[model samples]
Target: MERILMSLQYNGAAYQGFQIQHDLKTVQRELERITQRMHQQFVRIHPASRTDKGVHALEQFIHFDSHLTLPEDKWMHAFNSALPNDIVVTRVNKVDDQFHCRYDTIGKMYRYRVYTNPLRDPLKVNLMTHMPYDLNITDMQKAARLFEGTHDFTSFCSAKTEIDRKVRTIYLSKVIETTYGFDFVIVGDGFLYNMVRIIVNFLTDIAQGFREVDDVHKVIEARDRTKAHKTAPSEGLYLERTFYSEDELKHCVAELNTL
Candidate 1:
């Protein structure tokens, strides 16, 4: 079997999540179905990250092993032709057998978009989170920066997460101004379940003057999930990119910081 790596993007509103569920539609199931049809055999794909339901991905990755020869140059177009309108493979590459889509990942960037106004934009309703009132963008920006180091993100993770290691390093965390509201961008070595959304709500709380700016530190130090507010909605979350090496992660984060 030959190992293949692929980069893809999708509007996840249609799927239950990235992983396959017996009675539910999912991203993994769709890709597997298409790949199986093309190869004339079932091909299992392993994703770099399993995104949540209703979350979109600007740059997602997956790898699979196939017995049939799939021309790297033609696979993207072939898959696109068969895939649903919301999903598309952007690129494909042949890789060593040892290269894994999930295990080789070193870092990831996720963005949460927010739109503010009393009236919701029907078009963006599936993409951005709508806030009825304006948020203090400056305070949100300031609060986001505090998450830029190693911390036990227990307070920021879902109580349902089973991972024992709660400490993770955040390479970059900031809120960028957008015409509507703003986007909360976070780049990190890794994340716990629901961490990004929880952090976003915490930032929103700070921006709305419900909590002190320094409460972020208290939340981290408390190491208690109850300290954090409810998790933000899934619609705003986007898996922007995945990194495999330190050099790539550093360069991309540096480039992102300048934006």
Candidate 2:
């Protein structure tokens, strides 16, 4: 058997999410169906992260063990040919059998976009959030800084989360003004359920003058769900990248070297 790693990019607007669901169309379900058709066998695929409904991905990572003896590079071509227009297998490679996508991912990066114009742009409706009012980008940047470093992000997480630890490191968080609106990029070790969306909502509130900038620190410290703003809509969220440091990748290879 050989383990394969794949990098996928997909528009999430037409699917339920990444995970497989019987009644819904999903990235994973579609990929798995194509894999099974190509190999004529059952396959289980594990993903780096299960993005929520309406959340897109530019470079989602996943892995699976296959007994088929096909060449490594051909997996990309084969999968792409079988996938629909909305989903594409951008890259593929052979990896160690023990390399699980979720466990091996060192960090992930996400971007949330907002359209800050009085007149809504029909073209951007699928890609960005339309905010009719002007947003203060400078204030949003200041608010973004408060989320930097390690902190218990309980307040920013979804109430449905069951994880014991809410603390996660934010390597980078920035709000930059774009031609359309604002772009919020956040890179972190991991995120809690709805964490990014909630953070965006809070920052949006700050930019719109609905909330004070000092409230950012207060919400981080509060660690209470009620203290945070509502979760931002999923349409603006995109999984930008999943990363593994050179050292981490080396370590992973070393551990599987003898296999």
Candidate 3:
């Protein structure tokens, strides 16, 4: 058997999430079904991240062990032919048996999009979050800087999370103004449930003058979930990219760096 790794992109608006569930549609369920049809056997795929419902992914990674002898160049064409319109396999490669998608990740980058408008745009309804009020971009930028470096993000994660250790390192955090609105790009070593959403909401609160800039430090110091803003809508969150060491993903890093 040989282990193969593939990069995928999907529109999450129509699916439950990345993971499979009984009687529900999901990215994993669709991929697995198509893979089984092609290989004529049960193939279990392990994804790099288990994104929440309504969250999209630009370059999600997955790996599986298979005995099929399909050539590397034809894997993308074969998988894309069987996948639904919403999901596509962008790249594929054979790897050593020791490579594992989830465990081998070094970091990930996520982008949250928000637009300021009086009425929601039908075209962007499932693509971005709408903010009716004007935002203070300067204050929001200040708040984003505070999230950099290592810190315990207990206050910025979903209360439903059962993980005891909430510490994570933020490698990059910045907000960029776009034509219609702004994009919040964050790179982190790892994340907890709803962590990125909560952070975005907190930054929005600060931008709208609902929360003071110093409140970010106060909330982190307090480590209380109740003190944080409500979680942002999942539709605006996108898993931009996942990072691996130079040895693991040498060619992919250059492409991702330009994003």
Candidate 4:
């Protein structure tokens, strides 16, 4: 038997989410179904992140152990041919049997897109959140900065989150201007449920003058989920990248700042 690692990208609009749901379509279900057909046996795929419905991924990783012997390139080709058009395997490699995608990840980067044009762009409807009016981006940028560093993000996560430890370390946080609107880029050691989307809503509230930039400090201190803004729509969130090493994460932060 050999363990294989795969890097992939998917548009989450078509599926319920990344995890397998026997009754509904999902990224994992689609991948595993095709894999099982190829191997003539059950193959369980473990993913690095379980992205929510309508939350896209530019880069995601998964691993599985299969007894069928095939070259990495051929494995990718076979899967891509059988998988749905929305999901594409970007790369594949042999990995140690012990390497699990979820457990091996050291950091992850998430980006949320906001569109400011009054006229909705049909192309961007699935990619971003459209707001009719302009926003105070300068204030939004300030609010984004406040999310950096270590903090107990109790107020910024979903109330449904079962995780006990809300404390997490944010290494990088910034609002980058885009042609359509702006993107909230955040890199962190780990995240609780709906963390990124909630933060985006908080920043959006600040940009709209509904809240002050200093309110972020207040919200963080409150440690109450009700103190945060409503969770932004999942359509605008993307899992940008996942890192396995400290150096790779540091390099990505430096590279993102330059761009």
Candidate 3 on 1-259: residue-level lDDT in tens?
9898999999899999999999799999998887798789989999999999999999899999888888987888988988889898988999999999999998888999998888889999889998878899999988998998899999998889998999999877888788888999888889999999999999999998999999989999989888884899999999988988644343443443454
Q: Which lDDT tens digits does candidate 1 get at residues 25-128?
A: 99999999988997888888899999999999988999998887868987888889988999989989999999998888999999999999789999997899
The clash numbers for all candidates, in the given order, read 0, 0, 0, 0
State the displacement of the C-alpha of residue 63, model 1, in Å, after optimal TM-score superposition.
0.5
Order candidates by lDDT, high to low: 4, 1, 3, 2
Clashing pairs in model 2?
none
Give each model a TM-score: 0.96, 0.93, 0.93, 0.97
lDDT of 4 by residue, 1-259 (tens): 9999999999999889998876888898998888789888888999999999899999899999988899999999999999888899999999998888999899999999888887989998788888777689999988898999999999999989998999999998999999988989999999999999999988888988999999999999999999994999999999999999899999999988886
What TM value does model 4 have?
0.97
Model 4, residue 151: what's the lDDT? Answer: 99
Model 3 global lDDT (CA atoms, 0 to 1): 0.88
**What local distance difference test score does each model get?**
0.91, 0.86, 0.88, 0.91
**Alpha carbon lDDT of residue 224, candidate 1?**
90
Supply candidate 2's per-residue lDDT for 146.
Answer: 82
Clashes (candidate 4): 0
Candidate 3 Cα RMSD after full superposition onto the native fold (Å): 2.7
- Give the runs in model 1 whose Cα sits over 4 Å from its true position: none
Q: Which residue runs does candidate 4 get wrong by more than 4 Å? A: none
The root-mean-square deviation over C-alpha atoms between each candidate and the true structure, in angstroms, is 1.2, 5.9, 2.7, 1.1
**Candidate 1, TM-score vs. the true structure?**
0.96
